[model samples]
Target: MTEGRKLRPEERILWGKVAKSTRALRARQDEVAEYEAEITAMLAAEEAALARPAPPQDVVSPPGNQLRAPRPAPSHQPLEKPVHRKLAKGRLSIEARIDLHGLFQDEAHDLLLDFLFRAHERGMRHVLVITGKGSSMGSEGVLRRTVPLWFSKPEFRFLISSYEWAARHHGGEGALYVRLSRPRRSL
Candidate 1:
């Protein structure tokens, strides 16, 4: 192989002519424009989704086409798998955390409810509730059991969308990741 050297004046002139005679095989792609296009497509998809009537979430009776009065939505729902995975991988963020390690069940319940209310008011959606695993005896803690039960109540249902046990790094079975529902808009 020969070492590369600067082109002589005649070679440069010939190279320029050759370059001028050729054209790009394809137009240059603009990264910024591609990103903008992607965003536009996403927005269109979201709008289309909003326009479609969603399938029923709660089960209906009689297993027939007979339509009953639309019931209120179910209060409790299982945590979403994708969000749970994000929490497990540390990709998701918790807006706040509360520790109920030494507090009694009633106090913990009150605190949890208050914390959720304030967090919702501040527009925080995700939160961590640390209910320490009861003891070395391998039984569940009082708060851990009752905290989830509290979510079943009608009042708590208005506040929480779902709750699930946290990932290992998030205190594993000792803690919960709570997703708060946005307050209903006045229609």
Candidate 2:
């Protein structure tokens, strides 16, 4: 190994090249080792997670002795009384409306979901959903029956504060006055 001795230009160039190559190799080895350590830690964490037992889920036995998963608890707190009063009076102006008069059940469901999602994202507070009084069809309105059930579903429930039949002027039994949850601000 050479100490502080001055060397020929060619020798100096070769030595500098050797030093650079050695430093690069060491840095690469360090990077590989760091990656290996991270991968190992992740694998160990995954294995531990798998080994742990899952928490117990609530199960309910239905009327026909069929077991079913329990519905999640409602996420939204009850609406204030003044809000309810305004809604009932049709004072809280509707920001958006969707009429499901002509669509099939599946189509209505999809459209309603999309409408609510978009309304909520846009910071809409009051929206009207018209399902029409099923006068020609029979005694019960198909959409009227299904709409409330759909609102209670997990996907829709989070976005809704509360809902009720619209005032007679709005559409009476045929339409719903939906109050949407406030849009969450992104970080």
Output the worst ten-in-a-row residue range by lDDT, candidate 2.
70-79
Query: What's the lDDT for all of these models?
Result: 0.78, 0.78
Report the C-alpha lDDT of model 1 over 57-96, residue by residue, as the tens digit. 8656776677776766455667899999997887888889
- Residues 39-107, candidate 2: write the lDDT tens digits: 779758755654564566767666888866765545444546787668777677788999997578999
Model 1 collision count:
0
Q: In model 2, which residue pairs have backbone atoms overlapping below 3 Å? A: none
Q: Runs in model 2 with CA error above 4 Å?
A: 1-72, 75-81, 88-90
- By TM-score, the best candidate is 1
Task: Provide TM-scores for the models.
Answer: 0.59, 0.57
Candidate 1 structure, TM-score to reference: 0.59
Off by over 4 Å in 1: 1-73, 137-139
